[model samples]
Target: MSQSPTLEEELERARDLSVSDLADAIESIGFECTRCGACCTGHGPEADREPHTATVFPDEVRELQAATADHAGDETGDAGDETDGAGRDEDAPADASTEWRDVARPMPYGLTDGDDGPEGETFEWALQTDACGDCVFYEETETDGETTGACSVHADRPLICETYPFSVALDGTSQPMGEAVDSVTLPARGDADEAGDAAETVRAHECEGLGRDISRADAEELAAALKERAVRELTEAVGVRDTYEPARPGPGEVVVHDSEGAKRPDGTSVDD
Candidate 1:
């Protein structure tokens, strides 16, 4: 007898859906700019330092240069200096200003050995910073040059800035605010002063494009791409999982419990 379609095939079919099939769809769909400047400001200099501290991907560095060229003025040559005028050695190869191959070390994920280990490493991540709570690339401008300010690098900003409120990790997966304790808050809307509860905002804006909320159909497309990549990884790339079993808890050893009875390693019990 013939067999039904495989799970992959079914998943593919699900992905073929349209924009309407997604639950967390964006509502008004306005260009993102709360003038909050959260993306610009970071912690301290050590937190936002260059070289070993903050490394930009070759592509992003190029984009940053292009976007801020006009604003950089006489600081043009300073851009090529990896230190970005921080006084680091200018003779380094990584500081040579390669158009695209300039990869920074201390990247997000540590390198995994090819054969005997897990899958490939995750991508590197870095935060944007400047003197204030705004990014160096961030430009604040008003309609008549009399108003307050806003981000100038909105359009060509990195994936991080473009997908604020919803944060994407080193891995490709994205998480909403409530789901994560460390997520950045979404910008406040209208006279509704206080920002919504993290979880509430996440739930409310599930499909809002500004929050990196892709439609179910879009998710399907991405899933398909991932599936293909997975197959390749299993066959060609390094496999992440290793089967060596971990030592199981011994029989009499007191196990930690969340409810009712809790006990010490020596077997003394405590009440809820």
Candidate 2:
């Protein structure tokens, strides 16, 4: 059997990818977010009611924490009495102590959902989810009697979120990780049928906006981000492999493995 490519090999492949070529592929298969929130919520008809899980880097988690704290501070700036006319403190200060748990949780991939909670060692972090299994940062706004879904932390969202529905076919890196509920297969590259080779390296997952017309500038921008994501993912995989160490946790306890090393679900160092 063929052995899987090493992380370093994958990283090299990622670096060698041509951003211009990726842009051409993206332009060939266009996309534009319809803001349907299907990607952020579990309840969409095409979602299969599964929680949205996007890999987030440790630095991205910290960035999200900072963003949330700043937003809380803005909402609580000195404006007047905290109480409303009804004498209720409806405008009380928002919790500014945004912890790691507030922004992300251990990705559930290698964990087991026990009676107490998820138990086992997982890799990386995922954005927090609401009780409804929707992204915690996902919100809906009603304007002109039309409701549109939006992300509260869109500016600080993780790379996976930024490059949704688009993933590079590279080893040691799986963006849009799970089996896509729906996807668009691009045309064969060169003479794929004659050569028995796979199609293009760019894969487009489920999105209502797929097949729409995309401007050259937008396609190029997306391609750049996609390339960055591919490189980062492979780099992170190498880090994880180099730093990985076995851990033992009691029942109901969960450990997470990331590029930084092992950590508890709360983002605390495992040694702590």
Candidate 3:
């Protein structure tokens, strides 16, 4: 006699599930990461597909900048100034000019160029892409002239990255990122008819690792990581929101913030 639960309502109930229960649910199906790196490389020009995205939060942006700055300093003699007189190693990456923020731009989905709004710009950032349009952090390693994909900054990668091809489906139909394209369709749950439009779809991240055998232990591990990512994302989002000063005029309004600091919309630096 009662109505069905919505996706958000289902996720709320999912949040209260125990680790064992969550793992069991996912494992009952199965999953395993084979390190194919399809999600990382995305579709390329050779494949005639557009670049895929991994969303990032504001704090993660700061973290990336800090890491890049630290790396840059080490590459230059700057770290030497802070420590002993040892200059940078000769074998460092040559690009000292690549700053952290430069690695990411506004994702094209919900933004136009310079569309930071009349107020202040939100501080969102994302992983940068390379010349071929793959993630900049993604690298191709050649062993025996065979190529393999890897993340250059794996440890520092965002939560969206860590939990790719997997999410808590609201309809109690927890499954791989998706079942289309590179994914195989999930076995229809018993309540498929009832699910209707309420069922959440997967990202179908085009991973080769789906449908593999996943143990209870493996599912538990995934559950723990997903939980951690959820908490961290919310915390960072709140901190970022609390810190934003909306009254400050952004690019479209008056002055704008740029690499050289605040500037007029006409491109003259405020310092000038």
Candidate 4:
């Protein structure tokens, strides 16, 4: 099996990128989100959105939980100490201890086979989804019966969402995923005093805002965000690895670990 990249390596690769470098790289290939919400809705056995997966880091899970908790608090603040359910936040479950569970869930696949944590089961946490199988953070609004998708917590969305259709390579270069189209054309070398380096040549297909022009300011803004995301991800990943414990499963059984310890089939925690 291939080995994972070390945190130091990841950080080095991401940090080496300067704001100017990335700005120049993606300026011509600029992306303006059409907000069609195509990325947010495809998660199940559909042909167009098949094999959809949104990998959220641990801190992202915490941020989303906090967002819901804060929203819940606001909901009940007028009640004067009256709790939502058992005195927890209101946007989600009233169970203070397990409210985070309602906000995020384990990704399907191997994760679904585990016992339900509400009974004492423990498992890895992933982004929660609604009945339609879209991301929980996604909200649908209808005007004149035209439905539009919006993020309930747009400012606090996960890094991947912010860098949609674009990801940093191990080479520290930015490249757009081939799934999107409608991109801004970069300037020719003689067009500007110092034409920024050429943009990546990615296959295009769907985005409506693909051909729009983007200012240097917008590219710089994206660069700052991408840098921050890369750093934070590596930092958090390092922390997780430093404290991780290998699972010691029974001969014929698998195990799930949580902060409290190994969980029971009923969602209760027991000593490790």
Candidate 5:
């Protein structure tokens, strides 16, 4: 197996690439999403919108916060809450909760291909659609004089968007499963026209690296490496683990101790 780069390394590589370069890299990989809406529709049975999984940029977070704030006016500013006219941030912690942390949470359950059912169905963590199942960011556009609707958040779209034509399942291990379509997969539209021709060209470029089938072993290895990197980066980014205080056991709360040593919080330190 080939060596997988650590998350830090990947981040560094990302940082090094210019915007144009980044776009070029994605193109070279054979991903040419035509905004056909398939990715946003049920067509993506195992789609996720998590920032980590979707390559969310720092600016996207800031923009989202700003846009949501502007739209709400006087509602509430929070994950799903609307902003209120009072200018107060609705996402602020109330008198009861612990201090709020700024880091994004781990990617939630659904958003990917898996065998789990009902109780395990995962959903992406982003602006949800009303009844349409479309992304809140999905947009339709028209030429200059006409108002064109489009995902305002497209530029900084999630990591999942970048790694498309391939599915990475982050269960116990990171595994790359073969997507239903590769470059070889013919576009549903007949390939007679220029658009179809271009689509075919894009497909050929993307499938070059992927070995026809998704290898479970490769997926697990990649997942494990990413998990390690994520854990380390998260700990550093949040600095929460370093400051976390283990809960004090209540009375009669049996504390498991090893044969080598034991200690209690009541001013006692014992070593075997």
Candidate 6:
């Protein structure tokens, strides 16, 4: 059997990818989001009851927290109350205790569901889910009996969300992270498959917009984001490999191994 690529090799491969070629492949396959919410819901037409789970970087988590807090402040200001009447600054930074949990939770892949809750060691963070198993930030609207779904934190959404349905074929990394719902395989270079020497391929995943026409500009923009995501993912993988340390937690406690190090579900660092 062939050996798996090392983290360093994967990082080099990610860095060496050609963004222009990726754009060409994307332009060839084409895409336009249909706003169906399949990517954000637990029960969209193309999805099952599994809650949406996407890897979120620590910085992305902080960005979401700040965005949420800013939105809350805006709402508070609109209510015509800038102070608690006790002369407290209503615009103060959000309390990490309350806001952080709402933004992200421990990535549940390596955890086990226990009687008390999930317990075990997991790797990375995932967007928090609502009671229905949908992403907490997912929202739906009805207009004249037509329903459409959207992300409440769309602008600040993580790179995983931005580069959905598009991933590159690289050893030691899975960008979309699952079986392709629908896909168009575009070779990274010229056709040389019969000789078993073809380059990597750009993969398109499940989405209603797969075959839709896309302008070159939009395709390039998406390509750029996809390249950025690929690099970030591999970089993070290297960090995790370098910093990993086994953790032992009692039942109902969870340990998350992220690029930074192990952490509790609350985003607090776990003492070594």
**Candidate closest to the true structure, highest TM-score:** 6
Off by over 4 Å in 4: 1-6, 43-52, 77-98, 107-125, 171-208, 249-272
Per-residue lDDT of model 1, residues 135-157, tens digit only: 44555556765554456655655
Against the hidden reference, what TM-scores do the models get?
0.34, 0.84, 0.59, 0.64, 0.34, 0.87
What local lDDT does model 2 show for residue 71?
A: 73
Order of all candidates by lDDT, from best down to worst?
Answer: 2, 6, 4, 3, 1, 5
lDDT of 4 by residue, 180-242 (tens): 443433323342244333332222344555556778998778767766766766665555456
Report the CA-based lDDT of candidate 3 relative to the real structure: 0.54
| Consecutive 10-residue window with the lowest summed lDDT within model 4 | 112-121
Cα RMSD, model 3: 8.2
Give lDDT per model, in order.
Answer: 0.35, 0.80, 0.54, 0.55, 0.34, 0.79
Error of 5 at 8 (Å): 2.8
Off by over 4 Å in 2: 1-3, 43-48, 78-96, 177-200
Clashing pairs in 2: none
Task: Identify the runs in model 1 with alpha carbons over 4 angstroms from their true place.
Answer: 1-18, 21-24, 28-33, 43-58, 70-122, 131-134, 140-149, 167-171, 174-272
lDDT of 5 by residue, 1-272 (tens): 44554444433432332333223323333333445544443223346432222222233434555554444433434444543445445566443221111212212343233344222212112333423555555667767756443554555444444344443221111222223443332232342363322221112223334443334444333334333433333323333223333333343321212111222211122232
Q: Which ten residues in a row have the lowest lDDT in candidate 5?
A: 97-106
Q: Give the TM-score of candidate 5.
A: 0.34
lDDT per residue as tens, model 3, 24-92: 555655678766677776574676866655666545755776666566556567644443334445555
